[model samples]
Target: MKKFSLFGLKFMFEVKRSSKNDVELYSTSYALREKIIYLILIMFIIAFSSKIGLLSKNNNYSVGDVVISDIYAPKTIVFNDKSAKEKIIENMIAQSGKEYIYSADAGRIYLETFDEFFDDIYALKNNKDSNVDFKNLEKDTGRRIPDTMVKDLLSLKVPEIMKLQKETRKFLENLYESGIIQEKATIKYRSPFDKKIEKLSNLQRQVVETFAAPNYIYDEDKTKKAIEEKVSQINDQYIEIKAGTLVAKKGEILNERRIKILESCGVYSYKKSLGIMMANLTYLFIISTLFYQIIFNRYKKDILRKSTYRSTVLIIIAFFLTFRFINNDLIYLMPADTALFLLVLLTNTKYGLMMISFMLFFLLPIIDYDLIFLVMNIASMTFGAYLIKKVNTRAALIAVGIQMAVLKVATFGLLSFFSEVETFGAALKSGEIIVSGLVSGMIAIALLPYFEKTFNILTLFKLLELGDLSHPLLKKLSMEAPGTFHHSMMVATLSENAAAAVGANAVFARVASYYHDIGKCKRPQFYVENQQNGENPHNRVSPFMSNLIITSHTKDGAEMAKQYQIPREIRNIMYEHQGTTFLAYFYNKAKALDPTVTKEEFRYSGPKPRSKESAIIMLADSIEAAVRSLDEKTPRAIEEMLRKIINSKIEDNQLSEADLTFKEIEIIIHTFVKSLISIHHVRIKYPGQK
Candidate 1:
């Protein structure tokens, strides 16, 4: 008997090991499938973003081609011709003339000469020589004078000559100081002693003429610099092409101005089409590769599903097309934040931020590399995503929208402060940005339900809605199977605590647990929790039949969840909670009746718990049911029971597929023990107790 028991034990151990291996294999296959799906989705997005404009017939138009208006400008957009502006500015600079710079040194030279001449006059006057020499005066004055004129000057008294010299010096000083001594300046003088100005001798006229000199010197360097500075101060000139103006007629040849207008309106030339196509393809490849690398490194699990990645790609594509088709003036109102909001709702904040950044890069060329538009939209989208990240109510979206608008306005103002462009029409642009943010938020809020339904995504709002106990399915379960409902509530409590302790999704666990036992409502009388008045249904049914009834609950619950349109994640937990675990009581009874009965016959049909949340539900469900049946309700007994139940699941390899570490499992155990103690805690009876 001992040898036979050993053989049986070994056989059972092998079977359990094989079952664990199967779970691992299935998990690996599922993960591989998810990765493949994600790869295909990424490829599709890359192809879509890259080939968007390349395939269009209009993209083939060249500079020489005659084109008609397929689409008209929606408003009177006044586009500044960049090339024309550059040319106009250059012409303005070229036409500016050099300026003449005046110098004070010429005036100083004139004054010094007058003072020296006056000193000479005083020297001759104070000398008191018996005879004044006219020849010596002529030499000192540095001028040739006629002999007759010199003799005539000598004939005058010393006081008369001194007075004449003083008068001449004063006249020359005034002339130089007045800045009239230019290149063509001339000086004519008349002595106070001469009765007629025309009667003055040639020698006297020569003396006065020698003092007249050009004071102003031409400064080539200073003139050139002054002209350059004046030119630099002139603002850039632009050629404004008003909307509704015919840039080109049907047969008119396209000039540079018309070409600029066409380019501004998003018409491209086919002359460089190949180069443009290559550049766009290269950019798309680089961005797509980087995006994939980031997702693989940081958000592998979050975007592993096709639906999640596809939804994000679709949002980006939708926005891209919207911008492509809309009028340039209204481009700001394209609802950029809508993509970010959906991304946050679908994936997470980090992924949403990364995707939006990539989107900005893609939009740069399309928007004519407008940094203001790029920065404003990026800031608004980021703020919107952050504001709504933790919000769980639809009403909160309005507040987020308002806050996003305020943030966009502030962002626009800050950007405008640093902008080099004139702020003449900034009020209208600011209004546009504000409207864009507000309208974008409203649109996002309006379309959120549609996106959630279409993608079958479980956002925070959806999770909250599912958590409501008054939900139709939960209410039905409550009325049909009160015992199972109570059990579900207990499991939900346990799972929530354990999930929190292990740093898992607590709300997801709670909501999933609330609906995990809905299948029991179909036949509540068969379950032990719903058994009435000392009656056991298992007594009348065979173990095989009982196992079938028990095992069918997981499949039934999944179908019921589907009927109510529950999210796939929650339905998955319902289907995976049992995790191929055997109905131990029925299995034991069957083995007692017939020793040939196999443990596999009592096991639930399961692909095993494939996530932390599902695994947590599995553990909580078993613990709650086991603890409820314990007669000896003490802290020590409950702790021991919890350990044994956890150990059994571990040995059975039910949790092999879950991404839980040993440390997390230990934390879960501690949490479960504490919660069970509180639930089964003994209370002291007062004196008036029955």
Candidate 2:
């Protein structure tokens, strides 16, 4: 036995050369007709969404447009007159009186003034030493008192002066209590003792005048606050515009109010132009035709073979319907990136870009051709398609979404900056755009699994999940048929390397290879890879019976894949990997036993590999088994044997259906040989006999 390693998987058995070719690509007249039908259906969906309300005309009149007729509202409409309401509220507020809040210490100020006046008078009456001086008495009282009055008061007896002071204090206190003596108010007091004081000369009169002082202080702040509170109490008033009312007369320039009323009434006459409609339709037709041509010419093979084409159309229509029925400013929140992401995931980046273009061309009219919206959408789609090339994990998908959001925000910012609208409104619009981008990404990511499951499509994320060795079927295979499991792993490694070299889906190739031999688990003893004992099962059966058992694995694998709810692409590979090639040993054995046996009877029933990944897996599956079977494990011998196997497959028409050019095939062969050489390298021996 010879030992060899390929992509780090060690093998110690003779290689089994498979005679099956890669699956063939099929496109019949019915498939072509179906493509046409799907295209037409997609066109109708676009047209229906586009042409809705096409007959309704938009008013193009601005401020200068003269009203020819007295346009009235068709229905009773209650329009908000914001300006009028604001003006009314402002006027009411201006006319309203202010509220006044009295100071908490105002009473204390009055009390202090009264106390000072009484103390000065009482001190003068008693002839006691006091701080009140006659010369400065006017300053303290805020009024002038005669010098003669002070001299006369001091000359009087204590009892007479005391009685006069008591009477004066009582009169002043009464005046203060009357609320007439405000802190800033002037009071002229004519005392009841004025008649009596007339005999005492001008002294008493001067004292009375001096005693009268302003008591009430004006509070400017409090008064102003009161007025403000009154103003704030006024409510906004509305003006109703009645139906059948003349919003604007002929030759009357439209003011803001008149314009608002006219808009509210839905009053405007639009010129019906057939030429414009025809031009729009022509534009739609040209763009739609170009879109159809792009898909038909570029992705015809991928689309025609399955429901992917229909699914694409359906996805587009779903978006169209969303735009049609859900009328709102939030139409920007439509996950346009979702379509781009799906297109990139399902087909390629080129198709994704084309989808963005198609969506913009068709949806712009529906969105009223907003240039800012178009720019943002384009930026979002472009980044989403480019960034989400291969989403193997949910986290990677989220990261792609974040990238799209950042790009969208940047695009919106640029648009806002160039528009020269630097107001808060522009900032708010930018925020909305950013939010829409983020929401779009989330929706796209959230809907990815559903889309994959619904369309029976194999996304890279789905492939990763299926590729996990922990999966129930894979685990079962590993436990039940350990040798076969190892063989599948080796085949997957080879397929993945070849796929990457040829620029194919390496993940899909690897995942498909993993479950390709699952059917062998059903009859582990019959397959040589799983046979533990040296007894060959084929020795006990006829060549035809052995051939039947061998060929049935492909069918059985497909059935098991379906039972496990595996994706259609993987199931397809399982069915087509062995591509109706002759089982040489069994066919030859049968021919030796009976000369009339047909070659087809000993062949594996297969539809053949249809895609590049499937074809790569088919080659890898055969190559891995064959390389393992070789007795000569030298690098050069292995390379020569690999080339012979490839050449044999090509010569046998096994690679005919594979979409592989000669250049790509060469690269794949080189990659395979390099990987095998690394695995089969000769080890240095120390003092050992050859």
Candidate 3:
């Protein structure tokens, strides 16, 4: 034996040595061990792979690669766009080149150069050509310059130029050094420096104001260099995107810029979808492990022996296939409740609840984990399953549908409080929910007869139908053997109470009790119950003939049930009701005449009571007959007769095959005592009879 742990669960496999060879078997989850669920899971994967996008179309995606689908930020993304950083810095420096700055050196240089300009003009005047024409300046050989350079230069009077220099030169130089803005707005800061403004006389201020040139020059290279340095120290161009932001759309080109953004978010590729598929498949195994126990508790013994498995597969196919074709929004209209009721009717509530568990798993991937819709449907489905447990009429199914619809409406209303939609919209959606809920029960009842006939499920509705006195066989029994019919009804009534007390199917007990003696209709006059004139056919017949006539009723009832197309469950009850209880009167008479008489020869054919309901019918039938024969109509007499008859059954091993506890038998005895006492209560003696 080898034990290993996988997926948080331990599995053990025993390697057995056969005579031929050693064989190794792998241990796996129930879903895999049971090929049915494994096949269903395969179908699930194949059918919904594309819908849920479980398989990856393309996994190996890189930067600048376009995606096949929209990707979203799984978490907050914060990253610098490295590709856009350099270009952004370059643009910032180019814009900074236009700014002006104060340059005192350039201002002083201009003043000195102006004085040299005066020296050149005087030297020209001192030359032989004292009347130097400005027009001829363009052709001058030694130091030719543009006329604009000296446009104001030639206009200045000789003494005036010296005077201009004397008054403004000192102040203008200081002003330029202090800084004159060509554009005041270009200055980086508005706060003045600590230096005081130079005091100027009226004439000094006038000359300086009139003659000051803009010395605040823009050094493009210096400004560009400064900007480059400042921007280099600045932080990287980082972007912060909130969670769930759309990172990219399908087929969108993901350049380096977008790629950097994608890197900050969670990893996304087509391969992730493949991981989803694997994870969901594992979850399906978990779901199966959780439910298959209760669903198959009595699997082969009960409804599964019928067509329960086939019906289960059919429901699964119908649900998944319908969702595959119809709009997912219309999933509410699929009548899942009908499937749930069918399962409950065919098996039991616990099995139906187990199926609901399976349905929950089926719903997860189909609804894409829409919890609201999931809750709404599961609640309504469970409610309808429990509803059908007690109701036994076709008309009552309409009431069940109404109750389920009310449940759905209530669920939707509670859920709507969170969304708070408009009145009309909420009402409309609620109406839709109501319709969806009602569709389940309405359709279930409509197809119930077909399900019963096809699946061989004996539902409470079917049982009630069979118990009706108006049925042809039942009507014939009442007419031909009124006493037998009355006896059967009493047994049914008493058996129903006992079955209910013992937690058995009371409806089955009652319905089966009604038909347990239908064979007596064939030999009504031979039985004591229908011997209207107290005639004793047994007195006329030999003991062997009487035993044969009386013991044949069990098989006779079974045969009659088949002839009338009764459900096998009811037919089995008729055969097992008598078990092999010895007919003491006939057997004793036979032994008196012939010394070789055997108990088995006088006993009914012995299948014995194999179910709680059948065991209950056996006890109820015997007790009712014994209580009827008691001369004293008293509670003490009825109790003694019930205990004596029930004890006789117990001593004879009549209930050995039944699944009844001692406590359940006690409860059945107590219930029978109360019911029999009420049935045989002392009546008023008639005037002449006393």
Q: lDDT of all predictions, in order shown? A: 0.72, 0.70, 0.70
Q: What TM value does model 3 have?
A: 0.64
TM-score of each: 0.73, 0.63, 0.64
- Candidate order by lDDT, decreasing, is 1, 3, 2
lDDT tens readout by residue for model 3, 102-215: 665656655665455456666563464555454332232223444453445446676865675665576555566566656533532121411322355443443344334565
lDDT score, candidate 2: 0.70
For candidate 1, lDDT tens digit of each residue in 1-690?
122356446422322333446677578455755563455354445444543564466544555667554433333444666666567667866886534345666556545654565455455546655354445534555455455544555566777777767666665565555544233233322234223334444544444455544455445677667767765776544343444555555655566666666666555676555566677667666766676666566766666666686687578668676766665567665667777777887778887887777777666656546688878777777777778766777677767766777777787778877654446545667777667666765777777777778889887778898999999999999999999999999999999999988878898999999999899988899998888897988889998899999999988999999999999999899889999998888999999999998988899889789988899999999999989888988888888888898899889999899999989998998899899888888888878756
Q: Which of candidates 1 and 2 is the stronger one according to TM-score?
A: 1
**Model 2 clashes, total count:** 16
Best by lDDT: 1
List model 2 lDDT by residue over 25-46, tens digit each.
Answer: 2435445656755664565456
Clashing pairs in 3: none
lDDT of 2 at 251: 67
- Lowest lDDT sum, 10 consecutive residues, model 3, at 188-197
lDDT value for model 3? 0.70
